[model samples]
Target: PLAEKHGVTIETSGDVAVSVGSHALLLQMTMNLVHNAIVHNLPERGAVWVTTGVRSRVVVLAVENTGQKLPPQMAATLVEPFQRGTGRTHTDQAGVGLGLAIVKSIAEAHDGTLTLTPRDGGGLRVAVQLPAAPPDTGR
Candidate 1:
């Protein structure tokens, strides 16, 4: 829905291995990041890229979009609950800023870590890293 709203096409690649917990949480996290990218980006056609891969012992997932640059302070506080950026002018988007916070919590609960980096082309890339599932040993 958000991708269509901003005329932003989404491209996804790679795979993930989950040992436990509902896949819904991961889907929600991806949805939140994509929605934020669509809502915060400059109102021009853009693209959102979602990629997943295995990095050493961790599974890495990244969502990146094109948009206006974010202030360092605002970017730092993006994962905080109810935190909003100073440049935010959109009022129609219903968000209390708790989406990232929820994502963070869910990641932590799964023994994973979340990171956000400002992309070079005036956008943001959010990543979630989770430990790979342990090898099964027949008991």
Candidate 2:
């Protein structure tokens, strides 16, 4: 949906089990991240990928996208309130620049952590790590 509108491709994979405090909040977090990714992309032919998994009793979700190279300094402040990244100009009602900030708050509320890393080449990688829920075991 958004991928097509943004002229980008979206790829998702991995585990579907998430044990957040509220599913609705989780959905909001996902929406914000995906929206931010699509709206802030390279404007054409960009790619966004999301992955979910469990590691060391922690559930991990990562959203990465190709975009303008972000400076390390700028990236560190991306989670601050109203702090927009460079080249964030987009006509699609980009947002009030609170996506990462909201994501950080959501992760913290779940006793989790959010990390923003500038990708090696260009783009950014955002990771959310929270406590994992044990296997269902068909109970």
Candidate 3:
């Protein structure tokens, strides 16, 4: 597993029972989260926690990692197309900053929502929530 190769532990919990969108989009969104977790972490070695479950009428998928805390202003801009934060001093992890924006776009296309929160202690947490699939009528 790439997580193991990178020394990033994964903690997954709960069942994600909804199938509300294209599999491609789901994979893309998840990969984006994983990539961001690995790339943007503090590089001091940390774990990535992925949790999925139904909360109320929404299906929630969360990705969390330990890393340098992002500035509140920059966190607000994270979903803007091609907008890289001026606070990032790491040149090696360079990115156009479109990843989260793309994720947001895909989520919106699926009638879902994306959010980012500052993790307590340290790091960042990214969450995506989608409407639950309609009940199967077996028609």
Best by lDDT: 2
Q: Candidate 2: which pairs clash?
A: none
Lowest summed lDDT across 10 adjacent residues in model 3 is found at 84-93
- Residue 81, candidate 1: C-alpha displacement in angstroms: 1.1
For model 3, residues 1-139, the per-residue Cα lDDT tens digits are 6666667777888785594888998899889888877666765567888888887778988899987777676677878876654444345555767788989998899899999887776778889999989778999
1 or 2, greater by lDDT: 2
TM-score, cand. 3:
0.86
lDDT of 1 by residue, 1-139 (tens): 8678778888888876544556898788767877776776667788788888887778887888887787666778888887755334346656777777888888898889999888877888888888877767775
Better of 1 and 3 by TM-score: 3
Worst 10-residue lDDT window for candidate 1 reads 84-93
Question: What's the CA error at residue 31 for candidate 1, in Å?
Answer: 2.1
Local distance difference test, candidate 2: 0.85
Candidate 1: what lDDT? Answer: 0.77
TM-score for every candidate vs. truth?
0.84, 0.90, 0.86
**Ranking of models by TM-score:** 2, 3, 1
The reply for model 1, stretches above 4 Å from the true place, is 16-19, 86-90, 136-139
Off by over 4 Å in 2: 87-93, 135-139
User: Which candidate tops TM-score?
Assistant: 2
